[model samples]
Target chain A: MPKMPEGTVMQRLAQLLFFSALMVFAGYFSDSPAYQLLESGQTELKLVVRHSGNIIGECRALDTGEIAALAPNMRRPMVCPREKAPMRVELDLNNKREFTETITPSGLHDDGVLALFRKFTLDSGDLILHLRITENPDAGGLPRDYEKQFQVDAHSTLIVEYTDSGFSSWQPQHSPRPRL
Target chain B: MKVEAFLDRFFPAGSNPLYQLGAVSFFLFWIIAVTGLYLFIFFETSITGAYQSVESITHEQFYIGGIMRSLHRYASALLALSVTIHLIKELGMKRFQGPRWFSWVSGVPLIWLLFASSLGGYWLVWDEKAQYIALTTAALFDYLPIVVEPMAFGFLDGTTVSDRFFSLLIFLHVGLPLALLLGMFIHIQRISNSSTFPARGLALSLLGAMVVLSVVKPALSLGPADLNRPVQTVQVDWFYMNVFPLISETGAGAAWVILLGITIALLLVPLIFRGVPKPIAIVDPDYCNGCSWCFADCPYDAIYMKPHEKLANHLQSVVVADKCVGCGICAGACPTATPFKSVNNAYSGINLADENNAAILVRTQEQIRQHPQADKHVLVVGCAHGPQIDQLASDVVTPLTLECVGQLPPSYLDYLCRKEGVDSVLLTGCAPGNCFHRLGVELQEARLAHEREPHLRFKDVHVKVTTLWAGAGGETTVARAVAQLQQDERIADAKDA
Candidate 1:
């Protein structure tokens, strides 16, 4: 190996000091000064839609001529369209509308569930929250509505998810956050 | 560039931290892996037990456990530093241009993996910092259309963040780095004989620094994770978690845009700054004789052996132009590149088309005749990337700069000694460990020592030749060596009188 001029002794000492200082400083300030991720009293609101919208077209009886056009194994008395209807969702707080959206179902045949998500920021304390979700919007969908009066700033974040029974509300986090 | 020179002054070339940035990063990864394994021995991969288990290890077995944790985190930070610097330095040097674009493009994903793997390890701690990482990471991921269900839904409450979540975290923290290691391996696939380990002394110094830091101040967490309360202000490792703050400031959508935008820009940088591609090495079937010496010595794997085109049944070296960097190290490795009348085959089997090896010897002979009156004429051969060789010209010293020192075949050095007016030959290129052409110094030294192929076949070769690691701080060294050669010649003349 070709020996370099400065490395045998001086280089090692310098490496020790220089890298020691570098690692020291990096490890020191890696997590310092603290980051302000969110304000103490700021509230985050989210709307989640997991329920799939109903199928769009109703099944209709097929005539003898229509059945003749289909393949032997595929022939049936009635045929229902695989595509599902899109859903409409609207949110109102204290009678004032906050959000409204008509979300379409996913998948090739539009048979997938309506996976909708929306986020908003609102203030805390005594308020009325209303969330309305429509099962199917394309076919004059029925609107399911729920309303509740609660402290908006009860926790830093709040979520209203769609379930089978009705709209459910609670402090989603483990402990209720203290209002500043 | 001066910073690089200053570092070379204190650190040398092969062992310098700047030059070994890539290798040092690999070394740091090994340190993180070992320490991670030791921590896993005592870790519990469950939500309820994870934090408690880590705390116990930190306090009860603080000596081994705490130090390992500290080493794991610190080494990871160092790895990030080294990798980032390595990428920037290579970018500045335009090492990503031409045939090197593959290595450059392949490196883009390594940054993503570095962040992903480090962030995953934070989640394993189940601390406030982990909560922050998980929340921010999910926020960024949730914006993508592929994820129909929001990822933050699981961490919404006490019941949602399950044991399975911790299991996934452990898998990611372990699996992602293994993937990164594989990616690092792929990044060097084009360059043959790439070293993942730095020099012994350098690696030892790096390890020593990490150990000392771990001893001074061990790593600590920001308390257990509590989803019920908001973590307003938290301490986060700036290296891996920098994207989090951006996600917080700019909504997840914009953050995705910025992140992906930067990544795409990096992947396209080579094309943006690409210069006219240098010519690649070309092979001559007539002089090749299928020796395979160049094929074995090519750093970029650009040379291959195939059947000769015109010959009835013989093999010859072939150049894969797409993979060649035109460094001319292959020319130096060619056995046919000799200056002797019997072995005089100036055009080697595999040599850089841009450089005429035949003219190099003629130039040397002409330069030697210019200094015929000088009693001790030293022919100083230098690399283009090496010291400022043009400045070393004088009455007694004749300087010759090649595209690389490797472009000058060993036979040229041998031939210079037997020339009428030339007293001695001095060969210098990149530093001992740092060769712009990767293997120039090693191959040249090997050939001179008669260890590798195409040996310098001249009697008393050592007396006639002087090889030095004359790079950045090497001009003085080269000049001093020339003066010494003259001084030795004078002493010999006196003894003869």
Candidate 2:
């Protein structure tokens, strides 16, 4: 059996070291924002309002955009003059349970608009949104439609779900009594 | 009894352990290469990161990365085994004597390269063993006058040596394997025809073993490499790292000198040791028929087909001289008793009469076509790939015949190229792994590509040289392959054209 040259072993040892270093460098260089995002556990969420009914007002958890619970018999009312078009709202959330929602509405106005009231509840780690829309027959317009259920949490924050379809618009009706 | 007849009686087709072993080794190398590539991606070369990275890959990516690494390592080890076995089989059989001395001499370097490539791969892990290897290896280099300065200063001045030394080592790790690939090319260059794929069992077993090992062990790192901390105990790969301790104890400088001397001595063995020149195997053009069985059978890939337009046989016949490794596989494969005598017939007393008589029986055109013993009508004509042949034969009730497609006599080939009832004459020879025979399947294809010969001009001949792996008992595989080729209208058209 022929033996390998002595230098061959040394050369091989050197090669091994070199390749290991190169791989390390490659791994280190692969640090990008996208990679960081995945590593840090950041997620995105979209909220969409349904067109079936008017959305008077909504609240959400400041953190994680989750809906917060509402007090029993208490409601936040929002006014909508017309319901021909849709409305979109964007919100941001943090780790804390606090959240805020911003809504942008654009459409034609109708006299007989529906009033929307929504409440959020959180129980057993589940967020449930309760919605009540009131339509006025005294007005000349047709009755409002309530197509899908709205979800909320314990904090009574309105939960909006986003889909590929555009946001659903809502019209609110004026109530005779206002809680000051 | 004629020499050919005697050889035929004993060494018939599918015999020759050396040839079988050579085929086995070729496949093993491929297994090593593929696994090595997968491991290379995740390997970290730095002393600090190497072990950690390996650990992460093995623990976290065990299903993919870790398994691949283990397979690579196991395949590498197996490659060493196959190469060593091939070498021993050659020597014990006395196939390395005479004109084959160059190949024999070159074999030493090939082994050296394999070890070097394997060892380099081990060091990339940068584990405790890797560190020990690094330090001990530096010690060995300290012996060489050329490398002494770097070695001596490398230890004393950590920063100067560590980075540069490591960099140099990295260069070698990548470069050495490339060099080994070149050496492999050169090693088989002298042989007229040789195969890269080993026998079916050997190739599949090697691949299967690698897969199994990867799944079982899944290579992992030992620990983060620390230059300061001494690795008291390290797992040693004795195959390549055995000489490290020798250098550590004997002083690096001394070890280098001694090792250099030994290498020079081994390289010069063929020159120093004299032996009478042995006659290599010769080809007889008259009976050759250009079937290229010898070309396919040659373990060294030494036999080639040279164009001869005027001979009794048209097209090219097997020409053996320069590339002939004297393994006599061509003699064994020649359907016609064309390889009259062993190349070293003068020294070995090979009987040509016996060889010729045996050739007359099996080499005849009638026997080649009408032999009832031929179980499989589907002749897998390709470069002699032991593994593929074994795989194809094991599954189907067909006698899987392999021959250098290049040696297919244009006349008989024209007949078989389009003949009916021959399910599919799948020409399975060298493509990516070209045979030692200069004219492998590609060359034969090239000849057929321009204009189909008159005999093959008929439409039924379904000839195809595939690159897919063919294993034993892979009938569904063979059937699928045949079906696929049969579906190819172009192949049919080409045969008819």
Candidate 3:
């Protein structure tokens, strides 16, 4: 067997030691308590909506000439809404409601845009999430409402969004951010 | 400097036994498997029992449980580290090129399989890290079009948590490792005598280190997972869980893109800058003496001895062309491969086609002997893959380049020193363990030592012989050795006077 220089061997051993030490430091010692807590097992579900539902009985198609008559810079939405709806969310586990919230639509706003946002701490198990939005509850016999059910497990965040097509769900496929 | 040179400097002979990163990974896997099996025996897979079972293992069975847990975790982290190193080392050494694509390609999926196994193992613990992984993995799965409902629903509230879900986690924890083991087997299928384990000393040292780390800071859980409340604090094993943070920064789509892009890039690397394929070794039955020397020395297991009724010797060596790496080690191993001798139709039983032949060796030796210098005349034989032999001062030394130094039979050294009247011979090759042909340098060492068959006879030869591990950067070392041989020869002549 060819002999390796002793100095070179010692130098390499030092390098290996340094690398292992670096990994150990990064794994255990590189975080604050608060930041570590956020990354722990805590499951925070953040829900935000950017748009209100746009459900129309019928939408009229506008010609280019009609748009020119209005003004070059003026823009009109293609869909016409009868009434804006208040959003309601209910969290059910084993057929029992754990959380329920009613988000009323804005009365004075022309678009009746009601921005809904909520955060919840979910337990571990099967969960049924029911979402309903009524444009105008008093205008008709029953409220003009759209409802959908979502099921979520523990340590997960489910984002329920109100879009033009009713409720679109978004859940982070990863844990919460590093709050630290 | 070449990557081989860098490795040679660090892992000197015997100290770097089976130091290939892939083999290190295999050793780490064994450690994890053994420790994991010990831990699993005491583990409870039920949702309610999972946390308590682990706590019992840690608190009640502190010595065994704590140590095992730490070993499992550290070994897992080390496995991940070693696999990454293996990938980088192969990339640097150009081991992914040409016919060597199978191992490289299979290795990509093998990494994912390993990750999946580790992820499942974490989830089985049902600790804070397990909870985090479960939730994060669930969310990530929900992002895919294949998942209709968030798998996270099962973990949402304790009311919905069931033994079946816990069983699934346990199943995956067990199943993924089995799959990883299978994938590993496939990864090295194309390689002959592929070392899947590190040396005993290195393995024991690594095991000892992990054990010490375990005892020093036993792998503690981040408290038991509470479904009603979020976990307050925990230390993350960034090695396996780093992807979650990445997914946190970039949405799952982009994360998938980054992952898939890296995988695709790795898979396609062999196709880029591919060199022209070398011809495989072929067997000539008529010349084969059924010595089985080639069969024993073939690095790729491409040769086998078979019984043939037609020949004077019933056993003849055969070359499996598909498996042959065309390293030409077999041709050098054959006793009948004295291609330089003035014989009719000189050839070896198993020889590489076109790339290396007996004719080339005979021709090259003839050219080297064309010089008229009689005293202190030396022949410097070196590997083509290493430093070029031609770069030596050609006045005193004639250069002979072989595909690898191992491909030159020990008799070739005898022929040069005895018949060719060369005063001395200096043989140099790539440093040991860094042989591009895997076992070339090792075989050469064994042959020169006369510890193996087809040994060179040193009868009537008083020529000074030296072997050097002069890689591409070792030209100065080779030159110095040659000059010393000449100096010694001159001293011998003066003593005679």
TM-score top scorer: 1
Q: Put down candidate 3 lDDT per residue, B285-339, tens digits, no spaces.
A: 7677888888888877778778964586478888876677677888888887764
Q: Write the per-residue lDDT of candidate 2 for residues A81-126, one digit (tens) a residue.
A: 3433232232222222323332222323331221111122123232
**Per-residue lDDT of model 2, residues B1-497, tens digit only:** 12212222222123222345566666666666776677567755664455566676777777887777776666565566557666654554344455566777777887778877777766776665665666566555533433313232332212323434455666787788788888877777665546566555435544654575557445555554444333445555554565666665556666667777876765665566545553356655444466555555455555567764446545454544554534343443444422223442112111122233233223433434664444334545433432244444422223334334444433334344344234445645432222333344334454445342212333334443333323222335455665575466346567889
Work out the TM-score per prediction. 0.87, 0.44, 0.76
Error of 1 at A162 (Å): 2.9
The order of the candidates by lDDT, greatest first, is 1, 3, 2
DockQ per candidate, 2 decimals:
0.34, 0.00, 0.10
Off by over 4 Å in 1: A1-13, A63-66, A92-101, A118-124, A134-144, A152-156, A173-180, B289-292, B304-316, B343-347, B366-378, B388-399, B423-428, B449-497
TM-score of 1: 0.87
N/CA/C clash count, model 3: 22
Least well predicted 10-residue stretch by lDDT in candidate 2 chain B: B344-353
Q: For candidate 3, what is the DockQ-based docking class?
A: incorrect
Worst 10 residues of 2 chain A by lDDT: A31-40
In candidate 3, residue A149 scores what lDDT? Answer: 51
Task: Give lDDT for model 3.
Answer: 0.68
